[model samples]
Target: MKKRNLFLFYIVVILFFTGCVSLKDVSVYKNEEISEYKYALINSTESLTSNVGTTINGVYVSEGKTVNPRDIISGYLMKRGFIIITEISDDIKDKTLIVNYGESGRRNILFGYTTEVTLQFISAGTKNLVCSSTAEGIGDREADDIKKAITRALEAVFEE
Candidate 1:
C-alpha cells in the first residue's frame, strides 16, 4: 500500500510540472503590398505583467532581469528575409516596413502562465497597415509561454 501511494504521488507531481503550450483566437490579415517591403522596424508596447514583477518602459523586468519581446519578433522577421532597422531614415523609408508588437491578457493559473500576443505590419512611407495577427499561449513557465505565444502569433501572421 505504501509503495502504491508513493507511485501515485510521483505521477501527480510529474503531471503538475509538465508544460503545455497552445494557441487560440488566432486572427491574421495580409495586404498584397506587404511583399514589396524588405526591411522592418519593430516597435513594442508595454507588456502586461503579474503583480509580482515590474515593467520599465514597455520592457518586462523580473528579478533584475529584463525581457524584451522585440528581440524575439526581430528574429522571426529576419527568418522571413526582413532586414531589421533600428530607426526610420529617409534613405530607406520607401522600402521599410514597420512592425508593431504588443502583449496583453497575461495571467497566472494554478500551475502555469498564459500570454496573448499581437502583431501588426505597416508600410513606413505609406503609413498603411499591411498585416496583423493575434495568438495566445499557455505553459508551465512565463518566459516559455511568452516565447511560444509570439512564435505562434508570427506563424499565424505569415501563414507558416
Candidate 2:
C-alpha cells in the first residue's frame, strides 16, 4: 500500500511540473484574427540600468500616468503591415498593458539582488492573450524583461 501511494505521489508531482511548460494561456487567441494592434510600452526601470551599452542618458523617464490607446494601435498597425482606421472600435482589438519592475537587494554581499518585470495585457477583441516574464539580476534585467515581454506578446498574437 505504501509503495502504491508513493507511485501516485510521484505521478502527481510529474503532472504538476509538466503543466508549467504547456502554453495553455496563449491558446485562447489562436482563432482570433489579429492583423494589427496598438503598442504602448510603460517601462519601469527603477530596478535596473537603462540602455546599458548606449551613450544616451535619462531615457528611462517617469512612468506615464495615461497611455493613449489609439496611438499605440496606430503604431502597431503601421509596423505590422496593417492600416489603422479611425473607425477602429475601442471595443475590439483594444490592447493595453502595464509593465513594472521590482527589486530586492542585500548590501555587503557579493551578488545579492532579486528583480522582476510584470506585464499585464488586456484586449477586448477575439484575441484573449496575456503573457509576462521576469529576470533577477544586477545587470540588464530591465532591458531583458522588456525584450521578453514584447516577444511574448507578439508570440501570443500569433500562437496557435
Candidate 3:
C-alpha cells in the first residue's frame, strides 16, 4: 500500500509540473518584413465562444471565459509599434497589414489542456502572404492556455 501511494504521488507531481504553457511548433514563412507596415487589422476566425468546461450532473458548466483572440493580437501589434485600424480604407490599404488568426484546443485526460494558435499576415495592397506561424501551449485552464498560445504565436510571426 505504501508503494502504491508513493507511485500515485509521483504521478500527480509529474502531471502538475508538465501541465504548463509551452510553444509546440513554430513555422515562419517570411522574415521580419512585416515591420514595414504601419497599420494593422486583426481578423480572427476562432469561435466567439469556447466550450471548455466540465459536465456537472449531465449539464455542462463552463469554467473558461469567452475570450476573443483578436483582442490579444491587437494588443501585441500595438505593442510592436503598429497602428491598429478598425476599418480598412482603400487609401490605407497600401500601408496596412492584415492579420488572420485562428485557434483550437482540447483537454487532456491526464495532463491538462492543450491550445494551438495559428497566424497569417497579409499585405493589404498586394494581397500577398507576408508571413505565417503556429504555436501551441498547455495549461491547467483554458483561457490561460489560449493566451499563452497566442502570445507565442505572435512572437513567432513577428520573429521578436
Candidate 4:
C-alpha cells in the first residue's frame, strides 16, 4: 500500500511539472525603433454634471468620483512613454418630468434623468509625430471597453 501511494505522488508531481512547460522558446524579435517608441493619454470626453447623479446599465455611476479614461491613460503613458489626448462632448442633461394626480388632489411627479458622457481619444503624440484617433462612449460606458480602445489606438499609432 505504501509503495503504491508513493508511486502515485511521483507521477502526479511529474505531470504537473510537465504541464507548466507547454510553451517552447522562440527566436522572434521586435525592431528596436518600435520597441523604444513611447505613448500617452492626454484627455477623455467623460464628464460629471455639477449636481444630478447618473447611472449606467441600471447601476448608479459617478464621474470625477468613480473613474475616467484620462486617469487610466495618463497612468499608462507615464510608464510607457505614450501620450493620449482626449476630447469630450458638451455635457448633456436629460430631463424626465412626470406629472401625476394623486389622492386628495395631490400632485406627484418631478424631474428625473441622467447625463450622457461621450469621450474621444482625439490625438496622440510621439517624439516627432502627432496623430488623431477617435474613441467615443455614451452614458456609463464600460471601463474595460474604453481601456481596450485606448490600447488599440496607441498600438495603431506606434505601428505607423
Candidate 5:
C-alpha cells in the first residue's frame, strides 16, 4: 500500500514538471529594407481564448495588470543594444521598431500556466516585416517567460 502511494506521488511530480515548461514554435523572417531602427514599440497584444482550466486547478483568468509585450521586449532588448520606447515621439517616429502581437493563442488556467505569444517585428517607416516568432509562456502574467521570450526573439533577430 505504501509503495503504491509512493508510486502515485512520483507520477504526479513528473506530470507537473512536464507540464510546467512551455511548448514553443518559432519562425523568423526579415525584409531587405531593414535599416537603422533605434526605438522598439509594443503595438498590441490580442487575446483569442478565454482563461482555461480543469477543476483540478481553477480558472487562471488574466487581469489587465497581467503582462504586456512592451514590458517584456523592453526588459530584454535594453541590454541587446535596442532603445525601448513607450510612446512615439516625432524624432523617433521614423526609426521605431514596432513589435506587434500576431495571434492570441491558448491560455492555461490554474496555477499560472503558459500562453503562446506570437509577435511580428516591423519597421515603422517601410512597414516591412523584420521577423516573426511564436513563444510560449505565462505571457499574460509570468515575468520570467516574458524575459525568456524576448531573449529568444532578439537573438533570432540580431543573430541572423
Candidate 6:
C-alpha cells in the first residue's frame, strides 16, 4: 500500500513540472501599425466538444468557470494602450482592429490536461491578418488549463 501511494506521488510531481513549459512564442507583423489602432473585441468561438474523462490526481475535474479567450486578450490589450471598443464601425474600419480568437482542449488520463489557443488580429477594411499568435498551456485541472492557454495567448500576441 505504501509503495502504491509513493508511486502516485511521483506521478503527480512529474506531471506538474512537465506541464509548465511556459508557452513563449509569438509573431508580430510590423506592416500595419498595431499600436495606433482602436481595437474591438470579438467574442471567441469556444466549446467543450468532449469531456468524457478529465482528472486531477486521478480524480475527475468537472467544475469551474467557463472562460472566454476574447476576455483575456482584450483585458491584456487594454493595458497596452488600446481602446477596446464594443462596436466596429465602417467609418473606423481603417482604424479598427478586429480580434478573432478560438480555443480547444482535452483532458487525458495519461497526460493530464492540455489546451491550445489561436489569436488573430485582422484589419477590418483590408480583411487581412495584421498579426497572429498561438499559445499552449497545461494543467491538472481543466479550468486552469483553459485559463493558462488564454493568458499565454495574449502574452504571445503582445510579446511583453
Candidate 3 ranges beyond 4 A from true positions: 1-12, 16-23, 44-63, 104-110
TM-scores for every candidate against the unseen true structure: 0.71, 0.29, 0.73, 0.29, 0.58, 0.68
State the lDDT at 148 in candidate 4: 43
Candidate with best lDDT: 3
Report the lDDT tens digits of candidate 4 across residue range 1-160. Answer: 9999999999988767544432111111222243333333353336322333588899987553334555654665556554333432223111111111101111111221222122222222212322333332212224433444454444443454
Tens-place lDDT digits, model 2, residues 61-112: 3421222323433344357655434333554446433222223222222222
Predictions in order: lDDT: 0.76, 0.39, 0.77, 0.36, 0.62, 0.67
Q: Could you tell me the TM-score of candidate 1?
A: 0.71
Clashes of each: 0, 3, 0, 13, 1, 0
- Model 2: worst 10 consecutive residues (lDDT sum): 22-31
Ranking by TM-score: 3, 1, 6, 5, 4, 2
lDDT at 118, model 5: 64
Question: How would the candidate models be sorted by lDDT, starting from the highest?
Answer: 3, 1, 6, 5, 2, 4
Per-residue CA lDDT of candidate 1, range 4-98, in tens? Answer: 99999988887766534334567787775566888999985454333345679999876522346788889888998989988999989989989
Superior by TM-score: candidate 4 or candidate 5: 5
Supply the global lDDT for candidate 5: 0.62
Q: Compared with the true structure, what per-residue lDDT tens digits does model 3 show for residues 32-139?
A: 488789999887546445456788899988854566788888888899899998889998998898898876445454455577777888999989988887777665
Residue 62 miss distance in model 3 (angstroms): 7.2
Of 2 and 5, the candidate ranking higher by lDDT = 5
lDDT of 5 by residue, 78-140 (tens): 766677777877777788878886434655554456645567778776677776767665444
What is the TM-score of candidate 2? 0.29
